[model samples]
Target: MDSLKKKEQTLKSSCTTSQFCFFCTMKEPDSPQRRAGLANCFKQMPLTDDQENVLVSSGLFHIAMAQPDDPEFPSLGIFECMASLIQKGVNDEMWLRRDQNIYIPYYAAHIIGSYTMNKVEFAEKAVESGVIPPLMELLRGNKMSWVEQRVAVRALGHLASYERTFEALSTYEEEVVRLAMDLASTCVDVVYDNFVGVKDTRRRAKYQCDLLTRGVGGFEMENCKAEEWTSQLQCWSLYLLNCFAYKERSLNLICEEGFLRNLCGMWGGLANHVSPAGVGLIRILCYSKYGRKKVAELNEVVESLCNLSRSSDDWQYMGIDCLLLLLKDTDTRYKVIDIAFFFLVDLVEIKDLGDRSNFGEAIIKVLLLDYHKQNKVKLINISSSKARKAVEDLWDWNVERRRKERAMSDEKLEERRVLVGLIKQQASRLYCLGEIEEATRKYSEALALCPLSLRKERMVLYSNRARCRLLLEDPSSAIRDSTRALCLSTPANSHRKSLWRRSQAYDMKGLAKESLMDCIMFIKYGCIKSDQDQTATKPRSGVKIPYYAARMISKQMDATWLFATARSRIKESDNQCGNDEGQYYREEIMMRKMMDNRGLSTIREEPLVVKEDINRRKVERARRISKRATSQIGLPHDVGVAEIQCGGPTKRDRYSKFSSSDFISF
Candidate 1:
């Protein structure tokens, strides 16, 4: 200790006497001189993984963290170095140790993104220098880690943002789209397993009190920053897809099955709740007729939009924007109204959103005109006047509660509030232990002791009891509790748990329409992000809209036909209950108008192709098969058959005479 202290005491004197300081070199701003120094630092080559990673990861991390606004690094060949480094790190397993080399890919891609963020010229140069392929590798998981994918998507987002390089990005569109979809869908759980939990404390402990703080922060700062990065990683992946979606580059891949449902549940909005996360990508997807049709076909997406439309978040207009686009064209309007109508009718009288003054009225007008006469959502007396008052109160958040005050003072109310929280916690533990009866009785006792002014607490108690009722096979009691909980909540039916419980109860009673309505309402409530929780990065209050709730809605939507009742009415009039009567309801001429108006005539619906397109492809394949059969058997090319002619030798017999390799396409 004495020897080390003497060495440290003279360290500055040694530097001064030697006429050079390494600390000064590291402190200098990004310049050609500084960058040149870094390049030389790696020239003494063939260092061990431990030694080399110190230089590589440290240099890349700083450069990535302090990225200049003026594009200093990319102009100095730093971008090319980072690109080369990512390629090297991905290929070499020897140096890619868990503690060291794993950071190379992350920092390398972050450097590219930080540089290309402000300038289009830099992104253009990056594409010219071959950055997309290596970045795409990180996205595709050459290492199979979400850590690399986080920065990889960020870099590609910058690359795709430029007009000069989007063509290059679209070159690998299908794979990139598929990989990004999987990442967006599963990255959260992937990160939670590997980086979170109690057993992984050592893995996370290495990063504590480090880079997250540029200096002055404390109290679990490492975990908080990791969480922020995870959120950004998820949102950035969506941002990359948003670039493709907004440009309408790969609508076929963006609107693929199950992704829309995944997109709806991605509630990790922007860091400060500045923008709702997946809702923006979905809104961009709705710009085209093809996207609109595909988005409308899914009940989950529409109901989520219906829910998000009521949000007090900054992006509230996006939800209304998507629903309006879906309802704009008459061809896609009929069947979607039943899912959107009741959910949206609550917003009909809300003239609150500043972006669009008359959106409420406009929504009703669009539904009526495009919904047609026989198959329409009648807007007359939609929500009750009491529900309208709740919605009005929702907008005017400053308005005080109108309930008659109890005799208790503020001191007694505070004591009661604390007591309710304790009781609820006890109930939660009992519920987790499967003590449904005890939990229900505890929640009821809490409800009795709670003050009337404590609406939020009382509502939670009622919702909890509703869950107990559902578990006890008491559907009627569940319905009453859920309804009371709904009434207690502001903005009418925004309580997700109660709505889900009520939907299940209604399903038990065979009330299909009511169950489906509550199902949509349930999703809509989950989509409502608030500006209040932005700083804390907290999730929504209730449990997520249940999976069984979503399944119930999808099942109900399948049985729903907008004109089923009207078709039966027609059969009764004509006494002709034939299948042909089903096709005569309305001749939709808007498909051509939709194609021309949206300019999507060039984009084919490969994922959800029309029936005629399917039949045409089938016929083309059939002709090719017949032509092959003609060549094999001496039959004429004029005959067309899906299966070979009976007179010709069977496929097995012909293949037996010739080598199997002779007909590889077959």
Candidate 2:
């Protein structure tokens, strides 16, 4: 105790001017006896790295918790200290063990983010202090937790929000956007594996759990905390991506066609849902002519947006904005405008869009770009099955008369059904004669004329249309048509031909689970011929799956279980690539590179040997891909999106009042 006091006395004497304010004397061992003859609040003292880090963490904790008006919010030399601790956490695993060091980096980053949230001056201080690189380190670190990541992204976002610090963050542009993309793609799974998935309390990372519980409580709070953090991490990553998208940097990489298809589906768990999620990125991309051109060409992207425009999803208007941007320009208005305009017709009556600028008028203007009005049909209350007629039975005579009319209707329906069958026979002949486009059109013509009551004939036409779509390289439409056929069956999802065609369609879209399940269900409809309508959903015991179904099952199993397999389905003989058994050894490698680097890197710099291996793999990948260069490819959950500037919740586009010149009066 006497020697400890003497040591403190010597440290107090070593205090320097700059270090003085950044540090103050500590109660090293925390005992009242050391209070003897002490200055009570001793002057700042020089300290070693470990000692200084402890002080930094303490200051950061207090500052981060403090409101913005507090005097200590951006204290002297604090930015440099925070930046140093973050770099240490990224560079030195050993330092993380020294005196609450893990918390030091997190707290420091929080303080930086918190202070910079409302002020450009504090953000400028952060940029000048070299906070961006270390923050980027934590953002891109291989082993950092979501806790660290969220703070890093938040700080960078605040810094990126400002005009002065924006250029600093852009130094590592490709790396930053790619890292955020990978994070947005995999954060849910990452949180699930570590915090949510583990059942044993002892196995979970203690520091993370402590941070989640905020050094208190248990699992009950952890679930909610986990959800909140998961959302923040995903949102902030996209927010960072949005910062890039706002500036239009790396559009080629961001605009990768396959990535765009997956982007429309990467909607997150929860967010400042007012602006956008993945669709937010799409909207930003649509603003640019190059982005518009790319977005307009992808059939799947247009179809996905079309579906969203009609659904109850939050980003419905955002989807409309993307299609409008595409339609608003003539150079980019190609195939998708025709496809999307069909869906936007229903949205023409929508109002109260909050500064989206003349919602109804915008949709109408686009619709009238090359408009052609058509006559509409109105059906009477003569009742072709509303199912409402049963409740109002004051009409006993009406029922008997309707039953008598129904017999005549049935006989006429049979005649019409026969005509549909004859047309189907012609389509089948065209299909066999290699006139697939002609066959597809004939099937559509038959479907248009067929009555809704003719379920079986419509099922056949839909199944035939799905096959034609597959050959035409339009898997989205094929999936839609095949799904319709399955729903039309007596027992939903039971038609043998529909199941098989939908499975093939799913395979074409690179959806393994959907394809595999459909194949299993197809096999379950035991012994049914392609032409046979009398199929069962439940498999018969001791019945063998047919040769074709067996072959399909093999390919689907390969798709679901193995990685890096070929996905292109052959038209001539129903052949699928990746039947070669040699590529099966990459099950582990597939997880590592699945979604093509969708997973976050676990380390900062690859070692020489690892880099060499990557080079060799790239060559081999090039070789493999060249052989099947024409096949349709798909991206994983990791392809992504974000908002405009993610300063805070990356606020939605600020809609102007109707009085503004930007607002169109409908």
Candidate 3:
């Protein structure tokens, strides 16, 4: 200590006594002469270790603190000198014996790393000058101290930032990526082995931290267990992996080796910094289907994504981007929906409309695919607002999608209108000409070109097509088309027309019951009391009286056929004596309609109670008649009548429609 102090004191005095010393050269006045002097002094040939040691001990590292471009500073030759010292210090055997010697290169690498940050050309020069090999050596473990590793990692990160240095680092990309995967895989294995009882993630994370930070020994050991320290190393490794993610070869190797699962595992223990890089890497990898399948297979990957999505706003979108890709797979989509539903709900609630729109699609897909219709109702019942909004937004989005697909500008809309009008006219002309096939084709063409929202035109088109279909003897298709027309038509006249056409279709389909129902509905809504009434109320536009009369008579004949068929079917069922409730109800309805149409009262003459009483009296009368006939060996019919006549004075007899109370009379 005393010898070094005396040497430093003497060195200061010598520097003060002479203006031609290294210190004076370093801090020379601003002039062309001084610039040349400083440059010449700094321009020394390849430095030896002995000279570097002497200069470092004499405070040579301070000179490197200023950048090379400082007005009075020396040339960039200082970087060469510092880089040489770093290279020698890491490579020398004796240099590791003293703690102070390690820092000489550590600080030098810092300066070099910082200086090369903004200068790609300079970084390339440094790479060519071989600064990467020494920095890489520090990163590789030959039992370097944490402090040494820290600076080394940082320096490498800075160098790797530039394209040129990044390329230089690519030589070691395989080793670095594998190293990270091994650490992460080790962490996953540890957790998996103890996974049964390790339910608390934070506790598990602490255990990982302890295992890493404290090692198996203790913190005081040379290579203390610093999970945080290891995490720093992994961050740089992941940085390299992130760059490699864009390269197809490296990415496939990373995935094929099962490195991505370990990457996902890092989320629980090292999320704050590692997650963003890991997520970005996975996002890039998922651009291909196989990579997405691999990522989706990893355990707790969805959980990690949910954690990231909940961590911050920026991660939320990035996480969802990855999720959308993963969701393309069926199993992964269900898992994501199952585990992350509430988190996604929260995201949708807080995000702006744009993000919510995407979230809506995801939610709808999950609900549509994973849940059955019954389960969907239950899910909605649980979170009505979220489910409802999701459905509504999805519908609105679908509508907008269709709208955009049509690209319906004003010009296009006008052209479609003109085309639709001409097509419909041509179809109508063909229909009147009895060319049913040609008319059907023209109507279908018009429908294909028509806008989806034009309900009235679509209804007319569907109705016209159904007429053509009916002419073609395709009753099923005609029924479908007419039913659609009825659903779309709002006006009473259109409803009546649609109902009549549909009834005709059902009759042609041999569905007497359905035809009857349509006829009833048509009368119910159209209020057509009779064929004469329908004609009187019908709109008389462009119709000759003969055509109107013929049309009305045709509709009246169809109505008569439908009613007679329904009534005969009901009567046949009633006579079968099979207790058919449907037929009984149909009969009662028909009776009511018949009475109402004839302007007659709907009330029945015999009260229900009186009818029951009359039935009992008739049974008693039959029994008495049998007894009278059996009592007298050959009793005359007149004698049985006399007994009934004697009993006819009873009050029940006057209530009966017939004077006699026998079963036949009643």
Best by TM-score: 1
Q: When superposed on Cα atoms, how far off is each prediction in RMSD?
A: 25.2, 20.0, 33.2
Across 1-666, the per-residue lDDT of candidate 1 in tens digits comes to: 233234334542443322123333444597766766555433322233333343344554565567646555466566666677688778877666544555566667877888788788888888887888889888988563766788898888877777887888989988888888888887766654455322234555343334444334543343345455666777888888888888887889889868888888675522224345788899988888888889888988897787556433346578878887877766566546666655555455444355556655675565455223343243332335443343344333212222323555788789989998999888765554446678789999897777766778888888888877666667667766776677567655577777777777766666554565676556556422322234256643332222233346545543332223223333343333433332221111111222233221211111211122122223334435545655666443211231122112234433444432222110
Instruction: Report the C-alpha lDDT of model 3 over 1-666, residue by residue, as the tens digit.
Output: 234345545655555433334545545576776666644544441243332343332354344345532423324454566566666676775853453354466556656665565667666776776777777666664544334444566666666667667878778877756654553344323222332123234544333333243224431221122323444545555655666666554665778535675565343221123345467667777766666767766646666665444332234467667766665565455434545554444333221322344454454464344344345453343234654555445444445546774787878777887899899999876654445678889999998777766768877888788766765667666766665565455532235556556665666555543454455445445433333455776752221111111222224333333123223433343335432433343333333443354332231212222233221134235445435444544333222222232222223333245332211100
RMSD of 2: 20.0
Q: What is the lDDT of candidate 2?
A: 0.58
Question: lDDT of all the models against the reference?
Answer: 0.59, 0.58, 0.50
Cα error, residue 624 of model 1, in Å, equals: 80
**Which stretches of model 2 miss by more than 4 angstroms?**
1-59, 69-72, 271-275, 355-358, 372-666
**Global lDDT of model 1:** 0.59
Best by lDDT: 1
lDDT (C-alpha) at residue 358 in model 2: 54
Off by over 4 Å in 1: 1-60, 198-200, 203-223, 269-272, 370-666
Per-structure clash totals for the candidates: 1, 1, 6
Candidate 2 lDDT, 577-638, residue by residue in tens: 32232223222232223212221211111111111112112223322332232132321101
